[model samples]
Target: MPLSAARTALGSATAVALLLALVTAWASGTARRLKSGVLPIPAITFPPGPAAATSSATDFQEPYFPFLEGEVATASVSVGDTSHGFVVNAAQVTQDARLGILPTQLARGLDYGTEALVAMLEHAAAQLYGATKTRLWLGNVGQRGGGDIDFSVSHNSGRDADIAFCYTNWKGEPVDPPSLVPLNGQGQAPKHGLRLDAGRTWIVVKALLVYPRAQVQYLFIAGGLKTQLLAHARDQGESPALIQRAAATLRTPVGSASHNDHMHLRIHCGERDVLGGCTHTGAVHPWSKLYEGAKRLRTASVAATLSHGEAEQRRRALQRLVLLGGSEHRRPMAACLDDPASGVRTAAARAIAVLGGRDDIKPLSARFENEREVEVKIAIIQAIGTLGGAGAGRFLAEAVGQPDREADRLLRALDTVTILRGPALLSVLPDTAAALSRAIRTARLLDAAAGAEPHALDRLGALLADRLLDSDPIDPSRLVQLAAIEAASDSRRLELVPALVGLLQDRDPTVRAQVGRALRMITNFSYGVSWASASPGTRTKGLQRWRAAWRRSRGAPRDAWLITGFKAGGYQVPRLGQKQTWELVRAIAGADHFSVNAQAVLVRLLDHRPPSAQWSKNEACQYWLRWIRARRQRYDLDKPPVETSNACYRPAP
Candidate 1:
């Protein structure tokens, strides 16, 4: 498409996306506070003493709102009853667990209590439902890198949160954001919806009522919340009871994750979840549970089969098992791995992955190596990964060579190397690199000796860096992974320096480019300690390599050549603008060791059209939709506006 036509298309998309974002960005208006995009979404900066204590939850007096570009400003949170107020740094919200766009509430400070519940829910797994299911984080809040959200704040409260589930892979990565609406309760996470059953909603509410000091305990959420929480308050202290009573009065509107990103919880300090404090609460009246028929009901014992007619009867039972982590059934999740039914066995594998101990390693390994069925093997790998450790890594290594192995499986296997960063996980590296540091040193050995504790990482690295010594058309992902090895460990790729330098001239641009980026990182890490003091030859070589890569780059230079360096895009970068030029732009802008892309990345977006709104009313659909839409617009590939030879134009910076 012509450049002018591309600009027109991008403008249309931008208009649609922005309008939808403004319209659907409502739930976030009611959800709660957030600290996203606050102070650059980078690694946690450690304070000199005791991590600077990171301002305790109680220290939050006012809500935090980090400046988009400037320093995060703070306020004092002073709830009427609490004489002492805490200071809330707007910048600190990034670390807080509640990642959705929040809405406003009548009473303030109570939202923090709601955030506590979000944190726990963020940790919930299918095990909580007695299913060996793995969940994925629903929204960008739980994403590794930083992101922007269209958080709409009404009044002073922020209650929107867009959360999703995370499925624990064979790497045993953490899962967050359970879904209220799944895609017909299937595995296609993107197809999910947002309709939350009332009972499940009640579980969320009751959980919050149990904690006090959480000013948000009073927010009116579900109609049934007050009654449920009041019953829980029976055996608990008065403070909890007061909080539950306070939660009974809040009632408001909510939208799906589309525009707004979180489960908006508005806190009214003294407001009850119900219209009036439910006086009819005593140990949560079981009388409300009316069985449809005696024949349908099982005996009042664990021996009796559960009745499927009661709707959530099965779900609640599963929740019980999940809470117990297979303890309720014995041996954590071990029993399910061997279940006769494939689905049952699959679920068991997932649950056990999250709850079981190292004892599961051998069994999960056996299933992974020996299981004939691809699905079962995949499940087993995920279970081992979820369980996490050296065992998982070993299992992944063993599975890597299976015929026609799925790429997903390979990635899972590779992911195990970095997960948890525990000794059990690092054991997969060659030369016994127990953790990141050891992985670095061991990977440098350049020996294929299969001893002392060498693992697949060593094998893969040795094959590419030392063994495959020549540049060839290797699998792109493998090459990309090799390029990434430098980041995985701290060791420099000097041995492969010559190899990487040669790749710049290789026919395969993808291979050549990735090699160049990796090489840049190696040079940067080496210079950090003594760049200014390096020998003339070493400095010259580094400069010469950098200049060569920059000159050869088809598009923008990479950040790996700069301060942070390119980590590479994890998922398919959406096509932006009419011609969808991101791949082109990334190739050019990401050519250097600096954030040279930053200077031009946004400019590219400013030049393009935005995406159609993905905001849906259903919870799950809304969340994913908004994320896709917003991210698309923000990263639009249209050339950004800049001064040129003549008039302004959007294209290569």
Candidate 2:
């Protein structure tokens, strides 16, 4: 079954069951807060510590938006057996009698993964003679909820697993208490009273490589241990091809702590997970076909499946055709653009976009006019954009000029513009200034309609920067410029800062105010001047101050560029233009590393409840601060505030 279909069915049934349960509880007068799509909450009953001190269901229910820029896990974990994959019990790994717990308090033991991979590794280890009969000790995979595991950075999802290296005593007997003995030059642990179980370790490594369900992307280990394992495999007469794969998959990861103690196995996102919105970073590979359900289907078979299979099968077939990419499949793939099912049509449109030519534009445009589904239309527009020619460019320009078009369609038009303006394509069609304005407006609409994507922000910045640099005297409207500035600010891209700095001296006061806001968003430095009240000389001084600050911290070795201390003569930010200014201030004040003074100011703003059409900003900030303070009081007070959700707070910096 397609996991997407199962998810929908299960989620619906669960929602109904939960509602019935709530109704029963209400009849008994036992229900308190009847939250939407969630069971009634009793007080959190987990043991009182950082491990158990997670955000409550009620807390997440409240409106607060968290800015998450890193390895983000969206939506809830799928409802099913966690062992098969969606495990919610953080205590499961900790309490498992089979696994030995490390003494490190940082290890919360909440890792989850496919049971198939686990079984394969265990069975492989058991096959080795004189191997330790003890259960494998495991490390963090992910929290039960599948967000960032506090102990490790990349274990946000369930695809990562860490297994302890097998170690033996001097007598060549497996030890009860596991130990990490560094391998010597001769692949033996000489110093400690332990030795590396090379034969047994090789078994586990080979199992990972051969697992049907799991495609190991990287088996991170120490350089010496990797060398030791490869040598052992070669010595054992392992096939050169298999040994090559082992070497390719096993290597030291960049910017990670040395993994001499345990092997960190990172798996690619399963095909099922991809259908459920799991995004895989980096390149796609042939192994992807295994999970995509196309490993056995050749081009003819896939093309046949695309024509006669179920909608899902057709979708998968289209995807496989894309991966199998060849000129022979283009005609069949293009036929899929008109597939009855939207999913199939979407896949077909995407494939066609990659393979189609100028000759295909007319049919795509005709489909665009007739298509009812928003996603399919977007896909068609993208296809048209990718197949850019004079005709395709004209079609996109015409769409852009449709003032009465739906916001979603306008957003697609903006996307089409971005593609058309790429390296291979000519200039943005119709007019550059109009295109820039459309992009800014379209971005704002998309943010409200579907939550802004990162690419939209990039397009907005690029268009505005181009106009600022070009000889075109047609400056964008005040609203357009402000929208561009805000989009750039939200993106947190420092490269956009250089382009925005020039706008600080623009004649429009709103532009100057927004420019200042964008700069402050990128770099927390505020040159002691006000956009609304500062004279030309004062603005220049402020600009100069910001330039100097940017230079000093331009290439600073940090995740984000933020000032630690306010310079001696730094400008104290005055009250600027309404909602945008406070939004910026609220973001800074609620940031993970915002100074104590800034936080205190945020408290004041929340308490005072500033006057604005968007009153939720004040309420949202207050709710966030209240949650943070309560959480801090219960747990570690010094830990920085993190984005729990995007409802009431800013995204990660």
User: Mind giving the per-residue lDDT tens digits that candidate 2 earns over 338-452?
Assistant: 8888767766775565455768878787877777654455456556654555575466444432322332332332222322233212211112232222222222211111111
Which one is best on lDDT? 2
Residue 637 of candidate 2: its Cα lDDT? 44
Which tens-of-lDDT digit does each residue in 189-296 have in candidate 1?
343323322233333444443334232322323334334434444544547544435444334233322222223343332222111111111122221222223212
Instruction: After the best TM-score superposition of candidate 2, give how far the Cα of residue 629 lies from its true spot, in angstroms.
Output: 45
Q: What is the C-alpha RMSD of each candidate to the true structure, in Å?
A: 25.5, 19.2
- The C-alpha local distance difference test score for the whole of candidate 1 amounts to 0.30
RMSD score of candidate 1 (Å): 25.5
Off by over 4 Å in 1: 1-149, 152-216, 219-320, 323-332, 401-653
